[model samples]
Target chain A: MADEEKEQQKQGEMEELPVILQLRPVPAITPVEEQFLKKFRFLKAWESSMPTELFLTTYAQSVRVLLCHGGTPVTADTIRCLPSLQCVIATSAGLNHIDLTECRKRDIAIANAGDCYSENGADYAIGLLLDVLRQFSASDRYVRQGLWPVKGAYPLGSKLGGKQVGIVGLGHIGSEVAKRLVAFGCSISYNSRKKKPSVAFPFYSDVRDLAANSDALILCCGLTKETYHIINRDVLLALGEKGVIINIGRGAIIDEKELIQCLMQGEIGGAGLDVFENEPDVPKELLAMDNVVLSPHKAVLTPEAIVSLQDLLMANLEAFFSNKPLVSEVKDE
Target chain B: MADEEKEQQKQGEMEELPVILQLRPVPAITPVEEQFLKKFRFLKAWESSMPTELFLTTYAQSVRVLLCHGGTPVTADTIRCLPSLQCVIATSAGLNHIDLTECRKRDIAIANAGDCYSENGADYAIGLLLDVLRQFSASDRYVRQGLWPVKGAYPLGSKLGGKQVGIVGLGHIGSEVAKRLVAFGCSISYNSRKKKPSVAFPFYSDVRDLAANSDALILCCGLTKETYHIINRDVLLALGEKGVIINIGRGAIIDEKELIQCLMQGEIGGAGLDVFENEPDVPKELLAMDNVVLSPHKAVLTPEAIVSLQDLLMANLEAFFSNKPLVSEVKDE
Candidate 1:
């Protein structure tokens, strides 16, 4: 009788593995994603010879979950095509690629990459800040160019210890940055939209005020209408000639044009930028500056973070299938 | 009556101000050094018209304290020339700059910059490690050279979290590095001459064994006869193709030629080097590699550290003048 019961349970498990619809191929599906594929069957729209609409009409009719990333835009029209789509899972932190209003109207649930990226993102932000302050990259260039022998001792870099570091947003990533820097003897303060009652770090409601008091400002806030161009000329001037600015957030969070001008004219000390206003189109003038450090928007791309993202994505899918609370759901604001 | 008392106190203070002989001009003298100058009169050797030997013999008869930096070596002969010399105050960490054998033979006291550079040196070691592991400098070069647009996204970096880091010489700077990396979730292990009884991190008796177990090796041990070329080919190969090396300690601790070959052949993953075997003359072949981060031997040149060094130097001088125990005196082994 026990054998028969086990047989029934095995059959039930074998028959009930959930299906996840793929709107397009992910740029690179790592081993973690491959592991997810072994558990769930995918209805890949791009692989179908039929048009996207026809493919959605036929195959996606029975699919309840959609797996998407930054490269693919799950527009309202695309959402309208999938009648049975109840959940959209994003593999990236930012949701600008998704049409949120349409999903809200449709009463569909959304889950993002969540806290998987917070640690690595924070680490990268600190790395960029250190590179700028210590002239790590700039000195590397000097050494590589055979200038170290010709130029003698490189200029001294500012110390990170005891510097007033103002975090632009004390969100998950910002908080992680604060934790890591505190170990280096840096004092932490922050400016966010609202004061977090649970946090111990000093908070300021105005970013300009925070800039005035800070030796360095690390931008980690989300990109929104209110935050767009938030770090403008006034904030730069307030930070003064000895101040540094580090941005791991969106490009437009700072006024790139003004920042370029300030950096060129010595109006500000330096900058460490992961994201750019134009991206791939950094100002040519910045190429020669010894104080600036630039990266191509890759603060969150780490193998460990990607693996954690895969786990979170799988957990959200599993929870949705079992009628459980979404593990990392993005609720409508 | 108060005015007369104040005048007497001022005269006593003027009589007590220490006289120090300056062997050479420092690279740059900040306000802190100037403040020191106000407290003590410096006999500038370069400003004197007589030959250095003549100047020392003529003006050094009454001099008891000598001030020198790492660049100006205080040879045994030079120490012997100043018969009245009682103390040598070094503005650098390493004692290789001064003739310790002569100082010990004559029972002359010596003071070094102690604990002043530990914080900045540790900060720089972490920064260089971060740059190498995360490709901070490489990605910066990519963005600066306008290659980001042409190249889609830079390759993913390995996460710092959960990595096994082995620190060589668990001294002041090594301990500080351990403290900082712990917050990043990295596991710490160490290899020194002897196991530290108080330290909780795992200790390895042999460096090769440490390299075999660790994903990264941070060199912080002083360069001595026993430690010279300690990180040789065996250790590099033991660290293997995926391992990284970070050196904030002196050069010649690792075999530079072998390190270059390993880095070129992918025998070891990468390196973050502040001090090279031949400093100001880094291997030109390393110029093209994205895996290495090079600095111009400036792990401890911060303004804050310089100020602390000034304070420590002044305290050492004052302690010597007052017949008090030298604050950071280097005792002969």
Candidate 2:
């Protein structure tokens, strides 16, 4: 009787094996992670497109888990079609592209690599700050063009010391930026969901209030329904004339039209942006402005951050399969 | 017989007046300083060219003070001609253009406005630091030339944090550079004539040792017999591959040809130079290299610093006439 029951248990387990679909291409993994993934025999990984019909047909008999990176937004139709889909893992901090509400209704587990790129983001933010404050880019241009006259007027740049640096979100990236700015002799203040008792910086309840008080405002918040176009014309105007705005957050957090307008009007002194509302295609108006500094959204693409991400993701997978608690589990409420 | 004696005494007093010859031109002074100069009625303050004959004629009138700014260099012949010239006030630094030993033999007091430009020199040093570390000028070239691609690969730049900064001179400008670098989180080390007890930074006994240990070596010592060509090709080679050199000190303190060669060979990573061996004309070959950053010798010509220098000079003049000590008196020895 015990042998018959064991046979039935083995059959039940064989029927419950999950299938994995990788929608986006990732860079090649390191040798250690490749060996780790080899132990998951019950799972089948497919590098397939993420369309509804394709994913449904591809993983018909098994519970599906889709791994995705950045690109086009995922819709409710795409989520609903994956009948056996049990989880969705976004290998990025931002989840605006995914249909979170649909996944919630379907009782799907959702997890994101939120804090992986925090340090890289902060490093790039500081780089931009130094670039502008030191007038490095402008001076280089002067010499390269051979336009530097023997007795020409020197650029009178101001020191970064004694400047008010306002952080819009006190999340991982924001906190890191604050820490680095502190070293530069800047006074820090922030606006977050709630005042964190652990942090010593002054907290502002409103974003405009933070901007009004700061000599430079940095946007490091998430993009959500409430925060979409949060940094609008009013906020930019409130920042006043010697103010600089640095946006490393999601592009949707800022109103692109409003930012370009303010920059053109000189309502704000300057801007250093690494992301735009519709990236890979920045607004022509913003591109024309001399007061703005632009960088492609490669701030978080550092090799160090990428390696850390792969390691963390693989560890999470290992823990999940071993019936142990997952490292970064998402609640299904 | 008493009236005759009084008349004789008055004549003797008249004969004691010392003639003053003003060479070149000076800016108009404030009423306060002008009044102070009036008390020195023994000084003639006549404006004249420093031709050999004119200088001799002026010196023949028992001129005790010679106020000179610019023209030809003063030679031994000119100094001998000015036998009655008891003092020479150069309105600039660098007595290399003046015959110092000749003036010493004639027992003439030689004074200069050397310390007047100290603050300006310091400010320039900070400017060079900012330019090189931040890569401002290079980025500007890419931006202006419209060569900025969506993801252009510029050299990876490092912040000033966790780096040892070695100052070749701990004089006015080096001290100021130290103060400014403190904000950037750099560890300051310096080499000077003697260890400065008041300063908190570590002092190195040898410049080559300092260069070997430093991520950046700043030249801020004055050019003198003791310091001439102090930073030679050997020191540049000692600085190694990761090192940066910034020279705001006298250009003679560095061997320009060797420095250019070292920079070309990548013996040192880069250089930020404001002063070169030749005034108004920097080496065209050095300018062609991407590794070197160059600026004209106008670092100290900021409007604020220039105004401060003028104010200090006027204060010194006032003090000198009032039988008070000069603000920045140079010792003959």
TM-score of chain A of each: 0.88, 0.85
Model 2: colliding residue pairs: A136-B136, A136-B137, A137-B136, A140-B137, B20-B44
lDDT of 2 by residue, B128-198 (tens): 66446545455444443444555454453545555789998886567766776665457999998889899
Compute the lDDT of residue A74 as modeled in candidate 2. 58
What is every candidate's alpha-carbon RMSD to the true fold?
5.1, 8.7
Docking class of 2: incorrect
Worst 10 residues of 2 chain B by lDDT: B24-33
Q: What DockQ does each prediction reach against the true complex? A: 0.73, 0.15
Which runs of model 2 end up more than 4 angstroms from their true locations? A1-22, A27-127, A170-188, A196-202, A222-227, A250-253, A280-292, A297-333, B1-136, B143-165, B170-188, B196-202, B220-228, B248-253, B279-282, B285-333
Which stretches in model 1 have alpha-carbon errors above 4 Å? A1-17, A28-34, A49-54, A57-60, B1-18, B28-34, B48-60
Deviation (Å) of B8 in candidate 2: 32
> How much is the lDDT of residue B323 in candidate 1?
96
Instruction: Give interface RMSD, per candidate.
Output: 0.9, 4.9
Find the 10 residues in a row with the least total lDDT in model 1 chain A: A26-35
